[model samples]
Target chain A: MKGWIYQLKSVRKDKFCIMSFFLPVLVAILLNFAGSIDLSSLGELQFVLTAGDLTSETTEWLARYGTVMICQTEEELISEINDPSTNLIGIEKDGKGIKTILSGDEWAILQQAAGTLPLLYEQRESSAQVGVQILSRPDILAGYQHIFAAMTLVVAMFMGCTFNAMNIISEKEEGVVFINEILPMSPKEYLIQKIGIGFVFGCLSALITAAICFRLPFARAAVMLALLVLSAFVSSLIGLFIGRFSNGLMIGVVYIKLVMIVFMAVPMISYLAGVENRILTFLSYLIPSSATLEGIMDLANGGTAMAGKDTVILAVHGIVWFLLYLLLAGRGKKQA
Target chain B: MWNHNKGNRDPARTNHRLTGKSCKTRSIWKSLRSLLQKDFRMMRSGKFFAVALGSLLLYTLFIHFAYVRFMDMEIYQVYLYDPAGTQRNVSPLVHPVASLEEMDRILHKDANSVGIHVTDGKPEVSLYTASKKLDRHRSDYALSLLHPGGKYTPETVGGNNLEQKNRRDITCELLFIEIVAVGFLGIASVLFKEKQMGVMRVHAILPLPKSLFLFSKIFLFLATDLVFAILLVLCNVGLSGTGKILPGLLIQTTILSLVMALTVFGCAMILKDFRQFSLAYLVIALFVTAPVFLSANTSIKMTWIRFHPFYHIYMGLKHAFFGIPVANPLYYLCAAGAVVLLFGIVKTAFCREMEKEG
Candidate 1:
């Protein structure tokens, strides 16, 4: 444990390592600030939309200023146009041109009236016509949040893994492994220390993400932290295992980069494509970042704890990957 | 004496014959088997299967106890206003307020309501317009309210209601998220393990085709992901309902699985270590994922996001869930192109990885 602490401390002392811990947090925070801008815009759009419904003081004011035309028929509508107190009350008949013949400013007045209120006019043809497309606001917001959550998970996981993955390869290339190798520890201990360091780094990054990108209550924050720890551990194991297998920085780079694209990016693609199925959900537990993302989504949705299933899924996933990492490390001994 | 016997047999033209391509194919299989065997052995100690099983159990429990329960709360709080008694026949479920100010307040507080205001004795509805797609729905609702029980009822296609829609929608998202993010890591983590042991490089000099090394892992991940998908859908969305859509969903999942695996394989080869990879992952999660999620799931619209590749993927998944066929040939073409492109990149990266100095 002392040896582990010493190694972690030494890693922190390195400027690059220090930057690795903070950069994602900074980015997440920046993005959070940016996301908040959308919130304000959403608020503005909401206000504008709802504003149109409220008693249009202007309509009442217009009643005193302009000629009011209240007519049920086209001829009456035409006659009332000159009389000023005109409002139209008539059904637009199907397959016919305004049915009743009305001359003068009736057409112009009706056209002008149609502009203010939600008006429907009949276009006469053999087939009936009803406007056929509609969408709800909440559904729109839900879609936005869905996509946002996916993107957040992707970016967060990518940053989380890349920084951790690079450290392993870069250090190996720099012969930094020698220092740890020289210490009085087995390869297992060494691997464990590195994994621990990555976990801590991930925790810090997740905190940064939670703090800057989202604001949650303490209960939610704790749940998020727990998820971050597991996610980071799994990611670290992947990085360390890849670093161990790789011959140099080049191989290491390829390995980690591909992992991010496949594991992290594709899930978001699934989301973009609007797939909803139990199979995808089940698969979600298999991916380390998926849990992190789910957790983040729960937090984003104002939930304090991750849905019980997501937490268990992520935890199990992390443990599984960690063990696989160990086995791989053991195999590393034969080649080394 | 042995050489004479063999020469004599050959001179006699024994029935034992072989084609070069068949020989190549057999050797390729042998190589694949060996590679898969080695990976399986390595992954065993790593408890890969155990983890999967545990994840299955855990996710099952959580879904039953947590996720399903949590999502069972309420629908969008709908608020309506018509002062002239125009909607006397409107459903009582629709909350009718006396004034427009009340509607504004409710919408403001709700932030997610479809606001309907009858002004100048004509009903005009307003909602936070998020997408061009949603604009159509708003218009339909506004027009529908004008005549209660009108003949313009939208034809029922699939049996999914609003809640079921949410269920399937979220399920698909979680699944996609899992395969894309988690499966990618699974392949990488396993490969990274092998790579660290210098076994990947060893495969290069083997008598078998090198592609099998990548294929075996992809196959394993694809299978695992597919299985997980099956269970998740069956368990959450119900067996009977998901049954009809399973085959199509599986095909879509497979396509996604292969594409993501190849892409990650290429990326893992090109990047440095977990740290650097994590940074890249972060960038991807933030940028690529952010725009896709924002555009797909939220009210925030980026007109440019329609051009994004994942946007189509997300919409495709959504369509797939609702039993909608991804009828666009162009979509399939683009997805195939992406997969092929990623595969080529992975092959190139694999060669480069093989050439790297120890």
Candidate 2:
């Protein structure tokens, strides 16, 4: 509706901007899905269990997992499993862990299937004075979404800011900004319009990713959207600040990368969080992206309230950078 | 180090008698010294040096103070729903809730946690399953907390304690990412500056070898990463643990650094602008490294991960951090082969870039 929209429509015509917005989100989703695929599909395999008297339930579990056969002696189990009719895996009860013997086209699948035997055994032989009950756990999709959100938010926001800054910086590099400097429009308004589109694009990326990948409550999504808006603003302003030093695309690339790594690192390292990671956790809140990630994490974990600290940090990061950009880019000076 | 390269020619003195006779330095050393100085100046002028120093301090500080402690803490929160007094003698770590409704509410809030529903005196695991394999593992863990123990016993296999092992692991992972992402970006950004300035074309006509330009940047990045690795290990892995593994760690770092720098150098030479390079960065950092992390660290297995070059390098680095150097000659040979291949590719690209019209 504002001048920014008109400017954005024209820039959106550029193939580069469109691709930059779309590709990372696509890749993040693809990889997230790829990581969730079942690798234990042993596909047409015969598994033989020998040496110990396994409970029927254990045998049933093994049967459900693979094509399982049972035999008495080691030699018998080996012969049956190794027959041409079977892509073979022979798992015998070892001291505490199962000893898996396999060699086939599906050898890796057998190994993976066998690896789960420990925990399965642990559950079957669970010793207790009392029964345990259930509460809840994260849906596998949400588990993957947590990562997808971070990846998309970081990639889109960083690239969006970089592209936004690169646009203004490239215009200056080409001596086009000088022509616009003398126009009647105020610098603040023009700067806002240019950076605003970039901020909006960043929010779109964050929103599209969260909406598509994550299943958050409406209210939680609203909170996440607000966080995304602030993050985009902070990111764009920082991009503008870095682009101010653009001798060409290369210098801007360097500075943008330096900032992006720091931005990305906070959330990344914060994944290793605990009481001991307290300082690291606090440090993550200091970066806008990491703080946003913390908010999304909270939301993903079923948190109802906004992470107050993240709200404050996002507000602070957005305002400070915007003011800084105003001071730097607001003057409309180009580096000679 | 090799005597194959000759000494530098003496600079012609206008007044030889007044200027004392010029001494000759080895050609490679002379070219390398000037090339490194120029590269260092370029690095300082750009934000690369400052950013690198800042990164080193920030990463080291985070690792020393935050990561180790974080890794030591328990991984998953186990929530127990016992409406009918079914779960007695439940593990203290399992948070007991009054009703299934309350358990559902808490689990809805914390998906990362495991939830166990105790109903009718039987414990039933309730949670969103990520995958069949992962689900079984989580189910086993939650059930074990109710009545804990396996028919089989778990024996500690490695000498390093949990904390030490975690330190090496996280440290190795971070170092690998830093080299691949940050260090790779460093050479490309610096070279982009040279290409923009039309200096590559100028260097083409100069007495300096063309290979020197690329080598200088690679050496600088290599040195910085080596230093970062040293500090990272010292701060994160503890000073005492550094003795046996330093040599092995450095070797891995060098191998990785060369592979990454050469790959990026070739990219920078070929790509039209940094904007395009960012796209490649996304593919490499997100798609390439993401799956590698999944396959190598997490339970997720990709059938093709072993074929991926970074997987081998990651394993090599991981093994080195644990004080077991990757002894396979083939690994080194492949790394060396990759560097040579990339350098040749990058050289051709650089030459083409130099020949292009401004």
Candidate 3:
């Protein structure tokens, strides 16, 4: 109870810590705004650049594709092509044919469109023979919005790891650990209190983030909350391990960087890319953050949020890291 | 008292005073050198350089083995179900599906894939839609495959193929992230260590200017980042064209490194502990940098991104990677002015920190 009170008092004192609690809400709102943008109007044949002399018919033919901006010189065309902001493709008259100038990061479709312009212009009359009808199906995971939300939630949970790690490290730096040595609480109890506080904060951050980002049914929200609690349990254990081993804040930062990359970045990338590789799948399952993210994503996608593979994985991870922390704490007690 | 007065009037006393001034200058140089060495040692002990090397290796490997290969995968796979065999001249890239059920299964598995169902002679495209614009592109690409013989033979201007472009683009982005995120944290962690150790307070009583303390750390980080930029570019961008881009790349890197290092230095001085600094870092990483990336890389347009300082720095780095000189005088002027301003703020913060009671 004393430990919890101490932790709460420290959190209350730190204004930045309080601000971090609201970060996920801010990010979720930004993502919502981003999702609301009308993306259909973009990349619909707007600007194509050309230089040098072309007959009136050629110019008229080019006009069918998009608004053709004619540059007086090849230098000017090249200049426009080099501009990073402009999505212009430059065409210059070459002997009997034309050459395309690209900024090189143009979309594959845009590149193909530019490449096939001459042929498309040549067969403009007969190009309508084969008809195209687009049958649009409803996407299960709608757009990047859900994915972004899931990422935000995962980030929010992981912030617990940072908090716990910094908490212990700062205690050591401030000579609080020495004081704790003379206190009545056992090292094991102290560890529990630290992890418990982190877990509580983690759940709070996750809950706030989910509240802003999603409107799930009660059962689903309960399952998500359970999964988040498990995630926080594992994250706190990892933080305890980092704080125990690292000598200073600098080393702790490095460890956190590595942890975030392995646990957060790799899984997020795999999820976004829809990678089907078995090794990657296995790796993601093994990592606690990845499994938790997968569970949250499943829930967000309207999957039945019950005891599933991700739940088992996260539970197992919590057990494993907990055992490891106990063993390290025991070893430190023996050494002392 | 008479001997003291005689000595003060002596020529040797004047020579002694000149030597004393030179000794003071030499002592400042010595102090700066020792501070740099101490920081370097601390960084070494903290494994900062090791982590940097590891990151370099990881990034290089990902670029060569993963990112390039992943990018090389077809953007949208196109499947065609043509029972009448009307489209004889379809592109080989499009897979021929046996039945509508098979097309449905494939499309279900690969949501990004587009299916063209040809009945009689007309082709109808079906797919899980991404965006209206992207869906249109996928359908058009599917239709374009019908006339595979109609080739596009436009000459590429810069002559850099797709692979080269991807390499440069990804390298530039990773390097920027490394400097902005990792480098910023790296300086903070180091400074926080000094603060934790009471060394900063000791420096307050020393006969050295506090700004040299800031300068030494900044110089060390700047050099390290510049070296990292060189290696990352050389390894990923390759040797063929590195020469042309290195100068501009290094200049932009120096500006970014100094700005990040100094900013973090100031923050670390002001913030009480690593926990608070971590919160600040989180804010900067998510709020400050994320928007810059989204606006620059994606179609998501922000009308006010132009006002964001990091946006220009990011664009400047990108332009340098593509060998485009930022000809705007205002950019360089602004960057220099910002660096000077940050330096002033950091110095003031350092002074305040030094004055604070432990």
The prediction achieving the highest TM-score against the true structure is: 3
Of candidate 2 chain B, the 10-residue stretch with the lowest lDDT total is B149-158
With candidate 1 superimposed using the best TM-score fit, by how many Å does residue B171's alpha carbon deviate from the native?
1.4
Q: Each model: TM-score of chain B?
A: 0.71, 0.78, 0.88
Q: How high a TM-score does candidate 3 get? A: 0.87
Model 1: per-residue Cα lDDT over A125-172, one tens digit each:
110144221333344444454445445444554544555566667677
DockQ of each two-chain model: 0.06, 0.15, 0.38
Model 2: per-residue lDDT, tens digit, B208-302?
66788888888898898898889878878878899889999999999898888888888888787666777787678766677778776644447
Q: Model 1: what TM-score for its first chain?
A: 0.63
> Model 1's DockQ?
0.06
1 versus 2: better DockQ goes to: 2
Worst window of 10 by summed lDDT in candidate 1 chain B? B149-158
Best by DockQ: 3
Better of 2 and 3 by DockQ: 3
Better of 2 and 3 by TM-score: 3
Candidate 2, superposed: residue stretches over 4 Å from native: A1-18, A28-142, A170-180, A196-238, A241-255, A258-336, B1-29, B73-154
lDDT of 3 by residue, A1-336 (tens): 877888889888878766776777778877666546544434444344554377676666555544567777767777766565556767656566555667666657567666755555445556446455555555543644576788888788887787788788878877998998999998778987888777888778888888888889988888887888888778878888888887876777888888887887876876777768898788767778778877888887778543367888888888888887888888888998
Candidate 3, residues B54-168, lDDT tens digits: the string is: 8899899999998877674335688999999999988887899999999999988888788889887878878776655455555666677777765555555564666877788
